[model samples]
Target: MKDINLTKEEKADAIEAIKSYFFNEKDEEITDLSASLLLDFILKQIGPLIYNQALKDTHYFMTGQLEDLFSLEKHVQRK
Candidate 1:
């Protein structure tokens, strides 16, 4: 399985981007603190749901289940 490693700066940037995108004022109108709560909900709930596909891909490779599918498409031909 490929290691899921994020550098410190990448992690920090993602956090800040989420905060600004969800919570900051839009078109001069301020949103409520629900922005923060919504971000929290998404990170806790939706994030994992989205990551599940990656988990499946990784699991298959780690367990040798991807051999057939991966081998079906030859890298030499693609190049």
Candidate 2:
């Protein structure tokens, strides 16, 4: 899988969220750099798995919809 690139604003927001989680849940204070690094690691290692699962879910949903559509087809009676 290709690298996932986040926009500047998104990256900033994610970094802030990471910092917040560490502070709120772990009661630990971490710098922006630390949070950024952790975010990078997560995106690099875990992002592909999540992305693939989402694609599979979408494919399954579309396939079901197509089957439902096919069920509505009308058959012509032959003489």
Candidate 3:
């Protein structure tokens, strides 16, 4: 799989969120570099699993819609 790339804004936002989580939940303050490293690790290790699961969910939903469409088809009578 290709590497997951985030926009600069998104990366910055994520890093901030990470910092906030650590501060709020763990009562620890982390540097921007530390949060960035954690974000990179999550993207590298967990991103693909989440992406694949989303694809599977979309496929399943589309298959169900297609079956419903096929069921709506009308048969024509021949002489």
Candidate 4:
């Protein structure tokens, strides 16, 4: 699988979030480098699961829209 890539800003944001989580939840101070490494690890290990869930949500949404459209078309044609 291709590596999960984030924009520079996104990476920075993620790294900061990781740092905050460590500080607040874990009660440990994490450096930017540590947060970055952790971010990469999480992305590599967990990103696919999140991506798949998003795709499933999108597919279900589109299917529902299509079904509604077809139902509306049939209803209009019967008039």
Candidate 5:
């Protein structure tokens, strides 16, 4: 599957949604049941793809930055 891309705001929204699910609904008589059900719903709705893409994109940018820094350091040492 093609990777999912989430903007910063989308990421923040997703986190807030999960937190609300846990906190706001904790007093339900079947709290454990409801929490598990909601968590699964999230996973099904937008969990795996978004999270994996975020991780992969972050790694790609970090690797590029590291390479650039290493090259700059080498050039500086040579000067």
Candidate 6:
């Protein structure tokens, strides 16, 4: 998977959320720059794993749907 790039707006939103979480959960404050750096670090470290898992989940779901569709077709043929 390509680097998980976010739009400018999304980056800003995520940074804000991280800043808020630190304040709310840890009673610590973070600057916008710090939040952004943290976000980038987290994404770089975990994004590939997350992306691969999502692909696997999607493949599994689609395969099940396909199996269900074939089963339905067989049932219809018997009617």
Candidates in order, TM-scores: namely 0.40, 0.95, 0.92, 0.84, 0.40, 0.86
The 10-residue segment with the lowest total lDDT in model 3: 65-74
Q: Which 10-residue window of candidate 4 scores lowest in summed lDDT?
A: 70-79
Instruction: Report every candidate's CA lDDT.
Output: 0.61, 0.97, 0.97, 0.90, 0.66, 0.92
Provide the global lDDT of candidate 3 against the true structure: 0.97
Instruction: Give the lDDT ranking, best first.
Output: 3, 2, 6, 4, 5, 1
The TM-score, computed over Cα atoms with residue i paired to residue i, of candidate 6 is 0.86
**Which candidate achieves the best TM-score against the true structure?**
2
What pairs collide in candidate 6?
A: none
Query: What's the lDDT of the predicted structure labeled candidate 4?
Result: 0.90
Off by over 4 Å in 1: 1-15, 22-32, 64-79
TM-score of 1: 0.40
Which residue pairs collide, candidate 4?
A: none
Off by over 4 Å in 2: none
Question: Model 5: per-residue lDDT, tens digit, 1-56?
Answer: 54445576765666566667557776424344454555567666777778789899
Between 1 and 3, whose lDDT is larger? 3
Q: TM-score of predicted model 4? A: 0.84
User: Tens digit of lDDT per residue, candidate 4, span 1-79?
Assistant: 5788899999999999999999999999989999998898899889998988999999999999998887666434553
In model 3, what lDDT does residue 30 have?
Answer: 100
Query: Relative to the unseen true structure, what is the C-alpha lDDT of residue 64 in candidate 3, on a scale of 0 to 100?
Result: 99
Query: Which is better, 3 or 6, measured by TM-score?
Result: 3
Per-residue CA lDDT of model 3 for 1-79, tens digit only, reads 8899999999999999999999999999999999999999999999999999999999999999999998889998999
The CA root-mean-square deviation of candidate 2, after full C-alpha superposition on the true structure, stands at 0.8
Q: Which residue pairs come into collision in candidate 1?
A: none
